[model samples]
Target: MLSMLRLTVITLLLAPQLAGAESLVSSLSDEAIEITSSFTGSRIVVFGVVRDEQETLDEAEYEIAIVVQGPESEIVARRKDRIFGLWINAASQPFFKVPSYYVVHMSENFSLVASEELVAQYKLGLANLNFVRSAYSPEARGFADAVIDIRRRENLFAERPAAVAFLAPNVFRTTFFLPAIVPVGTYRVSVFLFRQEKLLAAKTENLDIAKTGLSDNIARFARAQGALYGIMTVGLALFIGWFAGVIFRRS
Candidate 1:
């Protein structure tokens, strides 16, 4: 009887941990996006489910954060200041690796999801992004903020708090808008699950953005024959001008 009781106690102790051992099943609505001349924007929906067995895991205590980041590039933000009654480039800061596009969707406000340390570690918000500084300066902080501000204005960086929607006990979904001016390149969609400031499970999916139709043709032509493309462009402009004049004269 004592041995049976010991076995029962061990099973009871292990049940919760086993329940916590869940996996994430995730996928994007579209794996690849093509931008054409008439392309305005697109909507991407990320959906996933956490399952331990056939049954879905309870997610009331869990928080989800989704980040879609475009390719990284070196960026410089210049600051203009008034000197001799004229605004001039007084200071500049260079960021070594900055994402061209960054958008985040969160289950709730960051503070409610996790501690500042964990959020910064995972870059759950814009303020936590570790855009490395090429050089150090006392004014560099303001420059960094200025860069982020400009990106925000251009809709390249955005935050959508409380955007995650729960479809079922284990399934969740979040959607983000891709702006018309978004850069065409590879992007990463990363989803993180956190519980009480501790990371539980994380998944990353790749997304491709490329030009299609006339846009793709023009880009390829420009790369392959730059001089010819320029000449053709001028010729086309002249032809269009001449055609418009002929039509107006007939009218």
Candidate 2:
């Protein structure tokens, strides 16, 4: 009887943790990225909510993190340099920066949440190039601009919730400002939810910058292309009909 009672007590104790793990749910409001220019730095904002299944737990604590990856070649070179500096060629050191993660606790009463992450600071000289002229002019004109640009880039920060709250469904939002000097390429935004150092949920979104424009003009161009094709089809039919009538009448 005592062994059976002990088993029952253990089952009850472990039930909540298992339920909590399954109950934790999160989602981003907007996962697609929109950028205006490839040469210029831009900002990305993420908004979403986290919800808990159990009503009994009125509050929960969590941590958030943003990870920025450097250019692949640079990252590989850096790793090699760190392992074997002497064997590697004496090239200029590549730049890499990582953001510190944020942690907060919240009660169940709160629902809306937000966070932002600026990625330009992770790379050197990315926040300094003028979005308009950098593509054409690769040289830095003067020292003052370089210094100011570098300073501006270093101050960038990732977005986070204004306040933390309980494990209830809530809206979260964040904004990121990218500088004009950032490279014209793809980037990533990651959101994480942690319960006292243990990661409970996570999401990642990809951001891309186009040299012509932030998002491809596919919708706009598709409509025009459709119309053009329709016109050509009609014109071809008419020509074939005319040629057939001409040949038949003559025969």
Best by TM-score: 1
**lDDT of every model, 2 decimals:** 0.72, 0.37
Model 1: residue 246 alpha-carbon error in angstroms:
7.3
Return the TM-score for candidate 2, rounded to 2 decimals.
0.39
Tell how far residue 3 is off in model 2, in angstroms: 70
Model 2, 1-251: lDDT tens per residue? 11110000000011123324422233334433344433344444444455454545435544444333212222111112343546554333222232221112122221133211122222212332233123233332233234334444553322223433223344444445555434445555555454443445544455443334533354345467988767776899999999999999999
The weakest ten consecutive residues by lDDT in model 2 span 3-12
Residue 207's lDDT within candidate 1 is: 87
By summed lDDT, the worst window of 10 consecutive residues in model 1 runs over 4-13
Off by over 4 Å in 2: 1-19, 22-41, 56-58, 68-71, 75-91, 94-169, 213-251
* Clashes per model (N, Cα, C within 3 A): 0, 25
Q: Write the per-residue lDDT of candidate 1 for residues 2-101, one digit (tens) a residue.
A: 1110000000001123225654545555577877777777767777765555344454466788898999988888988899999999778778778988
Model 1: runs farther than 4 Å from truth? 1-19, 54-60, 109-111, 132-136, 238-251
CA error at residue 198 for candidate 2, angstroms: 1.8
